[model samples]
Target: MDPLSPVYITGCGAFLPGQPIDNEIMEDHIGRVGGAPSVFGRRALRWNGIARRHYALTPEGRWLHSNASMSAEAVLRALEAAGLGRADLDCLAAATTQGDLLVPGHASAVHGELGGGALELASFQSVCASALMAAKYAWMAVRTGEANCAAACAGEFSSRWFRPEFYEGGALIDTKGRLAMAADFLRFTLSDGAGAVVMESRPRPKGLSLRVQWIDMVSLAGRFDPCMWAGASEQGRAERDGGWSRRGPLAAHAEGAIALQQDFNLLKAVIRAWIGVYLDKVDAGRIDPRAVDHLLCHYSARSLREEIVGLLEATHAMIPEERWFTTLTETGNVGSASIWIMLEALVRSGRVQPGQRILCIVPESGRAMVGFMMLEAVEAVR
Candidate 1:
């Protein structure tokens, strides 16, 4: 195995739970937060421009699929597409914001659910960049000859938190009788799904494979506070004595210490930080925007997309509007799974051609993290 061996994405698969839930029927699945429709939810839906999304819950809001199960299913599909069995894998890496169990890691749970021979496993827990980090690990493993075949997958089960029952006993509305903006904003924007990819040192025998050109990630946490988080009552409290762990389980739950929160005020800073990283990559000659045939960017909302466009144009690094591709409106924001799902959709669409380069950009506002991956479509080796 050559140290400089190129890693190829041999297969891509996605598992979107349940049917496409339209905007009108969203509440029917997630239910109203305070026993009634939320005005904030309605406005957020219109602004986010997500027409439909999937949820791992039924109309009754009961559990339909756990995070681990979804990731396993996606990995199985990816393995099938790669023409490999579970026994062929040397490493399994998974990423997610959270899993059903708190003790075992997400990758371990996915491996147990997948049921295969013992293999090296890695789990990444963060915001959206988790998936890219997992993919980078698999790519490095294959490139370094540490693994002949590796799989990286991401799953997001955010619908459970969006459910009204999750916040039933908590004070969801302010004293003005309005739902909290942070909580309501995400309910309409985030959804559930999982995506997986199989990576190997060589391309597949009879299909298109994306050769991994490079993967770069940057974190700006030192200059920014947490923009999106959970399992904490306040920004810096998660590390202090006032953290969620300090409060008893029941007390924490009752006080809404576990709710997913976002600071909209920091969104502009997130965009700027992401662009700064991109500029650095460009300056280092690692990326040439004009060489990218397709741009797959994971923007949480349409508004954010516009902001990104403005910055790209201002910096003269724009990839052109026509070259950009996204499934956000149709799939919503799947967090760690968004980039994988978008790539899977583009590959499955039959639009990509051999030798075309696809650039992927994923920005995470958990503390302003950004990931960039470049892939080149190549014909399968005979």
Candidate 2:
């Protein structure tokens, strides 16, 4: 393969486990903490605007699929859509917020579940931008002639963390007799799913292909404290004594450190940071806001949509509302898997035409990181 050849995303696949759980019935599945419904769940559900979402668990809160299994299923579907098989891939890249095991990397776990010949592998762990980072790695592998065919995937088994058992006998209520935001916020927002994309040196023989133009990623951790995190106390006490490992496991669990937490106070800063990054990209000539035919943004919640739009317009880097695409309301926030799932849906909608440009933006509030990718839809080389 020529080193100068362009890399194309020939196929995309997404797998959302189990049936769609409606907002009214969510407590029935995940169960109510403290043997009663949370007072904040209804308000949170309304604010997030997520009507339905899928989970990798049954009504009794028993897990039905592991993160690796879901990722493998998506990979198989992507390979099939690309008219290829597992043996055809030369590289596999995977991303997730957390895997089933803390020892082996997520890519290794996915590869083990996929069960094919040996291949190059990479794993990424972060909030929302992890999937795009994995895609960037796969694209580089194909573009640099290091591989002929590559697949990048992201999966989230977030439902496991939201189950009531995780919070059993823990302090979840505040002084007002309501569930604390730190423990209650994510329960209504997150869901479980996986998505994958196949990239190759050449486009498919007879269909639309997304030619990779550029992928840019940046981290602004220096400017912000941890906004979303787990495995540590919300007060940041663990950091002063080395880290979470310094605290005994029982102590950490009793302090509710193992549960996911978000600092809602920092959300505005996070959105502003995302807009600033977009403005920087425009100023550097890396992107033209007006030329973007489609904009897929992973904002994690519908409540932030207006704020993001306002910021974009204020910064003069606005892509019109008509050009925006999102599935947050229907799919909930699947963290790192969201962008890939959105891309797969857009490509399958049959609305894209040759020469169309699709821009993807992923903002991660975990220490404020963001990723942007641009792709041009092209006709396959027949």
Candidate 3:
């Protein structure tokens, strides 16, 4: 198989579970769950720069949907946009930090929701960068002629994992208190959503499509510890885990609830991950800063976005303020779904045109992973 076979993202879609929730509603939820955020938590919320986020749970805290349901819906919309159906799919790859279940894989759940398609299916869990990593694999499958049509998607049911009761259960005491607080800080910033894109070996004529020129991802875990994490740990490990959870400290096993844990060096992590990756790309001649037409980034905080933009401009005269794009403020950090949401917003804004270049940067703090893609928008081939 030729390594250079063309692959195109012919269609994209997203499903935001419910109305966007604001800080006020968030505060009310916390109150109802029996925990008042500490000053640090409240300040962290304000400084996080996310005003609203969509969640799958109701304000009264009801489970409305799972990752599989939202992802299936988004995939259908993407297939519709691509002018194709499930039968056309050669493969389906689903990614998420939060899956509907632990054993069967998110892809299986999605396949069930998609009415049991006869195509290939798989799932990935790599923290926040899972979606793009899945997309990269999907592109490879098509480029290698393993599939003609493929879908890469991610959906996160983050709201269900949040354990407000744990916070209110007097976990905030002594040195462990600040870690718990930081976890709450992250919980407040996370929202639930799903996004999907349909990729094809060939593009349709006279339509919008994005051609992937190149994409690269690097793990900074060994170099840094952002440690923004949730979920279970080795039950018997010496490391006491972090994040929100319903399981008490005395529980025999890890149970329901999302655990939030983070180190305080988030700003440093952002600088190192985002800026460091871009500079490395430039140094390796993989990217020409001046050739980047548009810049899309996943920075949950406004300050991080601004700082990255400033640093990039100072380093290379490439990205301008007008070309920078994100949905963080309105959508909050929808985890792995963020990049696709930003792409959709870019398309809706009508700022992108055929032959224009787009550079998307994604960073995840769960042990620090950074992924960036360089692509060119093109008129579809018939």
Regions more than 4 Å wrong, model 1: 175-177, 235-239
- What is the clash count for each candidate, in the order shown? 0, 0, 6
Candidate 3 Cα misplacement greater than 4 A, ranges: 1-3, 30-38, 166-179, 231-258
What's the true lDDT of residue 325 in model 2?
Answer: 90
lDDT by residue for model 2 over 89-135, one digit each (tens)?
A: 88999999999998799999999999979999999999889998999
Order of models, best lDDT first: 1, 2, 3
Candidates 2 and 3 compared by lDDT, better number: 2
Query: Against the hidden true structure, what lDDT does model 3 obtain?
Result: 0.75
RMSD in Å for candidate 2, one decimal? 1.8
lDDT of 3 by residue, 126-224 (tens): 777888888988888888889999999998887775655554434333343333454556677778999999988787565788998877888876675
Instruction: Indicate whether candidate 2 or candidate 3 has the larger TM-score.
Output: 2
lDDT of each: 0.88, 0.88, 0.75
